[model samples]
Target: MTYFFPKVRQAQQHGWKGQGNKAGGWQEMSRVGAGARLFEATAVGIALLCLGARLEASELRKSPVVRAVERASPAVVNVSTEQEMQRRPGMFPGFRGDSLFEEFFRDFLSPFPRGQARTSLGSGVIVDPKGMVLTNEHVVQGASSIKVTLSDQREYQARLVGADPPSDLAVLLIETKEKLPVIPMGRSNDLMIGETVIAIGNPFGLSHTVTTGVISALNRSIRTESRVYKDFIQTDAAINPGNSGGPLLNIDGELIGINTAIYQKAQGVGFAIPIDRAKRIMRELIEHGEVHPAWIGVEVQSMDEALARSFGLQGRKGVLVTQVAQGGPAQRAGLRKGDLILSVGSSKITSRQEFLEALSAYTGGSQISLGVVRDGREMEVKLKAESLSTQEAVRMAERQLGFTVDAVNQASKKERRAYSMSGVVVRSVEPQSLSYRVGIREGDLIRQINDKEIRSLEDYQTAMARALRRESVTLLVQRGSYGYYLTLELGGGG
Candidate 1:
């Protein structure tokens, strides 16, 4: 090609002649000049043909999926955590890894502890330029140290901002002098059923792995042995153990959900916490360090076939309101006892669990609309949810457990001197109350409620507010020298 360029130029300059033929007619110029012009035209055409082919190949390689990954991959991060665990020996010394035997005898194991350090790997996404990272709570739960690696291989030590175990969402903060890249958030409420979605995560210790799939389903519920997770966005993407906190993006490279691989038994099914729901919890976690249970002051029971028939609602789905707290949100909104709640906002309520899950989306002071059926007529009621007050919490404890508790500081000197720890002390217990039946005495100190440590009145109020929605509440009651875990059945007393 280089040799041809010089020859072509030489031919154009020297291959022309103006001469007369022997017949005295005008003579033709040199054919080399014409050939040179033809060659130049062919070469230009071939050059353009090659250029067009290269441009087409480039366009083909950059599809929407590729572009999305390119735009969002920088914000994806690898999360590694180290945790200290206490390993106890099994009853059968030789059956260490036997699944059947371990499952059968797990509860009978003794508390003989051995110290062990465990390391886990997961993925996260940077949501804020100030180094706010969002990941699953289980990723950093009980971790002694956390390390976050960005897409650029820059590693930083991370501190836990807050975690909500019930929601299974957590926030982490990393310190850096410069701003970090963040993924743009997208809404999940308007997501189509089969739209294209991409998941970016570290799967099996593989960093920044990309997988593409469609939204398989929405508002899906997953039930485990311990509890049920509701309102999950289901996708067929290949989410594995290490993909727990990664981003699920739409075609536009906007984050629509956080990928979670909770259902390990499925072949291709994976679930994600919807971005809309995650946003609500994220705000609470960042602002308050924890998510407070939103209370609407209504007690509901699942509507069965018999109950539906009794209420003249044969085929409609809803829950029956058994009680509405006086001066609470429901009562103030004109909701009464025996009202059939058909929906909470846009979410249809078919059972008590569904109602609770739907209500959990809102926070305190949020004005929500409830669809109700009163006297066989459908109506909507708007109410503002409020946090349960300390006084109201005490009354609720008495009503539910048949016991009343006061802050530790309010206890008598003898009662206060009896324990060196800080907690609430029982002021009184009704004889036939669930607490009394469980051998809880007046002098016993309540050290904990469920998993929450009750150190003050505010802690007890918050714990009781969250626990009252469950069927049973566990109390760690400390008598003179011994601590007892007592599970009290709620809604037993007037």
Candidate 2:
């Protein structure tokens, strides 16, 4: 390539040099003169070739992106999961990809029922030398089996420690006798926008793919489920579907955040969970098998001009308290309806999302000084953080199938009847839950267990008891609009 450009120049400027003596430019009487000219041309070509080679080598070293990738690439691993997916006739299996499809592809709504295995791939950072890996909770949520492949080509079966769905984080433990590479975490709070960062991930099943880009923005919010808010570090780095749970590193090769969500349809738009926010959540998950987000028992909305005028507030800023739970922390702190929450501790509250985000910074039982405006007067109120309440069905499911479900009541049944189904509604499926391995889903209906029809909670309990004793319990499940049969083994082998 280096010689091609000079060759083109030589052809343009020295086209007459290649002509015979008949051409006037090379009119030489002796062969010795022509030989001298050839030698001079060869020397100049050599010098130009050497200079180009040196320039290419010099520019390659100027980039630290390669070195940064080498520094953190070893700690990155590929996370692969296998789940049994059962599809019934005339039902929507749901869109589980990272794209914003709103619904699954319309073409997948088949008329024939089918059951098959599903495989999902993502990336993870080995934060612990003992083989404790951190990944996005959605990657292994409904997986029947989990596997982690290291950079050295060694694969290990991973065990789920805990899952925090609201945060989209999960911890996994894998037994390894050999020394494991660990990724050291840096402070995300110290990160500056426009600083160059590297993203190491497995995008589209390609392992250890490195992408470099500057931090485009910070404190970005992406709303997935209603009431669940996510603050992400926006970067121009190419983060694809399989890059979830990977590491976003600084030039010094320190992890600043974990890559979680991305705008699939758009280029140069990716989001990562800050390392600081993930650290506490990781500790809580590994210790308690659940995340206990601090709760104040007050529902709030972003303050608007209309609400501020109605409440007779000063500035139309901060969060507006809509409802306060009786006997809760807000009530105990003297915070009431129509009051505006100005701040939490030292952080200013601008919107309901910001208020919730500030509250997450506190753990259970921590005393926090809150700033609120009432009757156009500002005052400070103190309250202690408490663990958020768990639904009764979730508690029961945790004891039974290691998941959460709601009772199939008249109201719920009416909705289910659209699919010609009946039974409980699955709210959340815990990682490695018993029902998960058998291809059960959040929208699936549990109609019968071991040949016992279950239309109500009492019937479900009775059926569960009998199903627990059988070697392999068969259940008639109505998943969306299609009813199908699923068999679960007694020992969670289904």
Best by lDDT: 1
Residue 64 in model 2: lDDT: 80
* Candidate 1: regions farther than 4 A off: 1-38, 85-116, 304-316, 387-394, 409-422, 431-433, 436-439, 469-471, 489-494
Model 2: how far is 413 from its true place, Å? Answer: 16
* Candidate 1: Cα lDDT at 230: 78
For model 2, the local distance difference test gives: 0.74
- Displacement of the residue 117 alpha carbon in candidate 2, Å: 2.1
Extract clashing residue pairs from model 1: none
Worst 10-residue lDDT window, candidate 2: 98-107
**What's the TM for model 1?**
0.83
List, residue by residue over 163-232, the lDDT tens digit for candidate 1: 9877789999987868899998899889999999999999999999999999999988888755567788
Cα lDDT for residue 291, model 1?
A: 76
lDDT of 2 at 39: 72
Q: RMSD for all candidates, in order, please.
A: 6.2, 16.2
Each candidate structure's TM-score, on Cα atoms with residue i matched to residue i, is 0.83, 0.59
